[model samples]
Target: MKPVADATPKVTKSEREWRDELTPAEYHVLREAGTEPAWTGEYVDTKTVGVYQCRACGAELFRSETKFDSHCGWPSFFSPLAEDRVILREDRSLGMVRTEVLCATCHSHLGHVFEGEGYPTPTDQRYCINSISLTLVSESDQG
Candidate 1:
């Protein structure tokens, strides 16, 4: 699928560099478009307020205020930190069609975004992201 264009400068890296930087699990998810087992993610039940960054490129992608408990196992967000912060593309993998989310800066696979699910959130969209794909910088860390 073609990536959604944004004005943010891109971050390009070699395969070996990515492999060297990320752990096996992180690489699989962020670089290989892999999904972690449901309920196995670190941010599934997290309640801390923080900014969520792309694990691959350290780009701020989602804010803690946008996160919500969707009970879908993965960490869900109603929206990204900014529309330009992520790229959404149509995914046709695994014989199912879904919107694939990627970090705009590095084009790293973050996860999928589901819409019109009747969620009480303002956007009514659930960004079902893998926790392994993100790193949270809690409020305290910003101090």
Candidate 2:
């Protein structure tokens, strides 16, 4: 695994400056650590064929083919395109034990990952991701 420094986001601005650039919701979810309502995220029911990337740095995270309807009210992917693109941190917030996933490049809060529950994949892992933390890159962008 890469060192935490390589995955931790570097703050390039003052607190006030960051607040000014990102919306309250974005800052809350990406900076202050908050979550959006499940199933209400923009990508939950989206059928657009594309790649899901980190919103902050546009790093390719997951492909549409790996997405599945886990009925968990969140965008769930069987696995990430690159294991290095995301860093898993042990999150013990809200009195619950969960593995939180963050962007390796920016350390922006993505969501939590869960295992088991008979997922289609052999790993039985479900990466429950937040739509707000991602940007869908259309196929045309690959050119």
Which candidate leads the pack in TM-score?
Answer: 1
Writing each residue's lDDT as its tens digit, candidate 1 over 110-138 gives 99999989999998899999999999999
Q: What TM-score does prediction 1 earn?
A: 0.94
The C-alpha stretches of model 1 lying farther than 4 A from their native spots are 1-9
For 40-123, candidate 2 gives per-residue lDDT tens digits of 899998877889988766678899988888999989988888787788878889798788888776777888888877988855
TM per prediction:
0.94, 0.86
lDDT of 2 at 121: 81
Clashing pairs in 1: none
| Clash pairs for candidate 2 | 39-73
